[model samples]
Target: MTSLLAILIGCLYAAAIYMMLRRSVVKLVIGLILLSNAANLLIFTAAGLERGVPPLIEEGQQVIAGTAADPLAQALILTAIVIGFGVLAFAVVLIHRACEVVQTDDMNEMKGTD
Candidate 1:
């Protein structure tokens, strides 16, 4: 599963880069979102995948002393998701404003000296 997930992440990164290189502002925004998702996935995959065990510990235990899913990964992913959403939203807004002024979503067309 880890190997498969790793491959998936690689594919996503490749696609994201490909999209980012396109001549469309919309594609660039999509690529940014993909890149963010790929990063989150990489972090998730780096954290070991374990079966669903509550990440809890008894009061006397100094730590979670069993096979429990790491909460850190979940927390990190959650934070990334929120931040990614905000970034994506901002990018979209910027794109919209650019389109309104430039009258096109093409990167080449957006380059105006005036």
Candidate 2:
């Protein structure tokens, strides 16, 4: 399952990069979102896949130490999600303003004084 997830994430990353190279602002924003999701999935997969085990320690369970899912990766992914959302929001607003002010979304058209 982890290997499958890794492959899917790789594919998503490739698509994101391709979208980022396109000429449309909307596509670029979507590409950034896809890239962020791919990164989050990669982090989650790197933490390993365990079965039938709760993350928290139960009372009187007497389990072995250091054989549990890494919570740090989950925390990091949450942080990355919040940060990515902020970045996406900012990018959307910036793109909207750019389109409004310049009357065009094309980067080539924004160039001037050359």
Candidate 3:
């Protein structure tokens, strides 16, 4: 499962980079979303997958007991999800306003941009 997740992360990175290089506003937004997800998955991969055990210590136990999950990874992913959503929302709103002004989704239409 870890290997599969690693492969999926690679694919996500590829797709995200590909979309990010396109010349469309919508593609850029999609790429950003993909990139954020990839990063979150990367964190998960780095944290190691420990199943069937909780990430807590019982009474009188001085350590993490068993194959407990890393709570830090979960917290990081949650924070990343919220931040990514906010950023994507802002990007979408900006894109919508730009489309209204420029009348197109092409990246080459805005003034003073090369």
Candidate 4:
């Protein structure tokens, strides 16, 4: 499972980089979304895949017993997801406004705004 995830993450990163290099604003936004997802997946991969019980402490235990999920990784991923959504929303609005003023989505054409 980890190996599969590693491969998928690699492909996502590659595709994100490729899309980001394109000349279209839409493609750039898509690339940014993909890049953020890839980063989240990378974090998950680094955190180790364990399907154990949730990270909870019993009434008399000082620390979590046996194998347990990593709360820190889950928190990080959740934060990343919220940030990614905000960035995506901002990008969409920016693209819409830029298209309205520039009348084109091509980065090359948007270079002469002055």
**Highest lDDT model number:** 4
Residue-wise lDDT of candidate 1 within 90-113, one digit each (tens)? 999999999998889998888962
TM-score of 4: 0.95
Model 2 TM-score, all chains together = 0.85
**TM-scores, each model vs. reference:** 0.93, 0.85, 0.90, 0.95
lDDT of 4 by residue, 1-114 (tens): 999999999999999999999999999999999999999999998999989898889998898879998889989999999999998999999999999999999999999776
Q: After superposition, how far is residue 11 of candidate 4 from its true place, in Å?
A: 0.6
| Candidate 2 regions with alpha-carbon error over 4 angstroms | 58-67
Rank all candidate structures by their TM-score, best first, as comma-separated numbers.
Answer: 4, 1, 3, 2
Model 1 Cα displacement at 20 (Å)?
0.4
Model 3 scores a TM of: 0.90
lDDT by residue (tens digit), candidate 3, 45-87? 8998767476768899898765777788999999999999999
Candidate 2 Cα RMSD after full superposition onto the native fold (Å): 2.5
Residue 41 in model 3: lDDT: 96
Report the Cα RMSD per candidate. Answer: 1.3, 2.5, 1.9, 0.9
Q: How many residue pairs clash in each candidate?
A: 0, 0, 0, 0
